[model samples]
Target: MRYLLPGRAAWAVSLTRTIVALVTLFSVATQLAALSVQPSTATFSLDTTTLTIPQVDYESAIYYRDGDPYPHLDFERVDRRRTVRKDHTAVVMENRYVKLTLLPEMGRVYSFVYKPTGHETLWQNDLVTVGGAANDTGWWLWIGGVEYTLPGDEHGTTWAMPWSWEIIENSSRRKAVRMRVREPGTGLEESIEIAIVSGRAFFEARICITNPTDGMVEYAHWVNPQWTPGGQNELTDRTEFIIPTDRILIDERWQENLGPSPQAWQGNPLRFIRGWSRMGDVMADGLTGGFYSAYSHDADEGIVRVFDPDKTPGVDVWTYGYHPTQIPMGSGGPNAGYVEMWGGTSRTYPDERWPLAPDASLQWTEWMYPYQRTQGLTFANEDAAINFQVTPEARRVVIGLCPSGEWRGAVELWRESVHDAADGRAPLRRWEVTADPATPFIKVVILEGLMASEFNDLRLRVGSDQDGWTIVEAEN
Candidate 1:
């Protein structure tokens, strides 16, 4: 088994126009191929950032606009509504008598989806932010979906904010989900892919962040995956979270919002029980279950759940279902909690928490799995079931980050002790994460060879849990 790192080529911003030319050329070539096969739209709308396919198609299932305002692809009715929340924005459009709404902040969809190929809508309410803020809003990155419905999860914002989406159908059967963005200021393009085949979904999403300018650029990205209506409660249970031993950040505001919390509670700022949640103490009181978490599940409807090692830990994982516990807030909203990729959100924390990568490009990985339920399987046994084997020849990366100042590492996730997707039990704790990194180098855990169905979606959640984590920064 080879643990060799994979091939990666990067150019700093100092390479100047030469690098730009090369990147532009490469980007152009890729864009051209994307454009070449993209289906022509009858009408396009700038107001909603939409391209509608009027049940008519000619080219492949790809659509290309190059971050530029889409010119054509005729659609009627462009509407915008400003909510009471200043930071909230909504764009609505309709075509083929179908209405679509785009809520920029909400984490994801949680309703029903109409699919000729049998597609279902997941959660309807959206996450405001991992840290929960209606203050400064980030850009809304929507992957490709042609049709979006305003009504699904029936959330409060489901009416005001509404659900927004895009679609792409190629003659080729391969499905892809990701509408990547190249930050207008710094042309660092980050993207992801999601698809549904044979009634199941798979994902491969990422940010190919390039610092094209002369100076170093810092940025952070979140892996957002919407779970089904039952709530990810089932998934949150029976889960294990793994990460580098670093100080974790959390949301303090959530607690103040919750007011008088339970006496039984011991606050771990980095924990999912942000100060804001009684965590359904009235109902599940002594247990970790929330009404929402209780409703979510990770089991297959009837058949056995499968496992794959390479793509997911097979057995070991970072989360079961995304629970309020994963975030400090009793509510599992956007502001709940997440991770900080790269050097973007680190310094916001206290202490010597400077950029871990500084001027270097460090790489890290996180994976998810939906395998067969083997309650008491050993690592070796579970490893094989997941087809995950990290060998010497397998591509590997030795990423280093600065671990100065306030740093912490946490593995918080939710799970269902009861396999019922609707059992509505809060996630059960399955593992204890005590950091004991001997040489400042935590073992890079990789679950390899994961098949598409073995996991639902590939979501690498990025946000400062509370403040941020400090790695052994990349050294010269």
Candidate 2:
């Protein structure tokens, strides 16, 4: 899979007198032809590799606090004395568009690379350090990547422990690895099946939490990913968070730096990581859509995480700040600043918890993928991401589409709103194109002599005639 757009001749189409020129920039014509004749079956590969990791060594001791608060949990204290090298096992799964790497020792995703661009979407540490203390554990590992934090607050207790893994699927269409760990405090089981399927751009993680106790239990489950979508495991000032929520709650500790809670995010300066001077967490009060993302304007690349808003309504953001001493200690460098996007089962962490009955399990699915060449993202679903922006002053309309799989269809732009087929309205302009995970469709339409106010009514529809069209509203 290639990220750079293939070199192709550009042609212009004149649809009407007001439509000055329509240029098709990126189209996967050759790929479409090859896919047409290929079999419908999906193909993927799964394997294991050993990695020599550089980490800090610590002398640790575990003790139980009797008659103290939270007596059921054990605490650990560590003396970070020296650095050492260790070998860890890594499970890899790959498809046409993406490659996923998981570490059973850490029980988290170590790396997620967009094969097209050869870019790692997750923030990975160069050196691991376990020192910080949290609510549930006395020592927290600062190793990067996505970790499933559960059954306790903060970084949780099982993140630094070794997990049991097995290859659950080896079919032609799909390949997956399941990682399971039981929390020592609660004896609750956490199982995650990370899989890749043929012809799809995104990888899916099916997470299941089981309660084995004889009575009811309350816990908090969060999927936490340290993101640096710009690649090379670094963050920049141009990185913009694409959260589809009107209001958010800022943690009290960061209120002075991030602003008041239950406030609008449209004009918030901290929406970009550069605006923060200190570490903090920001959480969405509610979600207007099913996806949230982060895009780097300088790199022209972005990553999206899609989940059911009803099932996982909690979305939070955490950062180490632009300048932090922990970055050097944790990653062995000062340039590894990254943002954390967390998806949770409840609205708030620690404050809110979900109850589970004995022998019952809760499960949900999430998809993560990369997209490029879009100025920004307005809306996204499992199928595609739509970027539609109109400049009324310049009479320019820019449209971009990044699909998860092969797509052959017509992209139509209408001057007036078309509610139904019986409206008998014609589109102002239409173009037929083919796209895929590696290929994105971008077009710039210059509508000459059109009033500036008319641009507000423009709407876009994309799909094949056989599959029906999906209407996407314009964002100015």
TM-score of 2: 0.84
Candidate 1 lDDT over residue span 292-343, tens digit each: 1111123311011121212211110111123443332111222222211111
**Clashing residue pairs, backbone N/CA/C < 3 A, model 2:** none
lDDT of 2: 0.72
Model 1 superposed RMSD (Cα): 22.2
Assess the local accuracy of residue 367 in candidate 1 as a C-alpha lDDT between 0 and 100: 21
Off by over 4 Å in 2: 1-43, 59-81, 323-332, 448-450
- All candidates' lDDT scores? 0.23, 0.72
- Each candidate structure's TM-score, on Cα atoms with residue i matched to residue i, is 0.31, 0.84
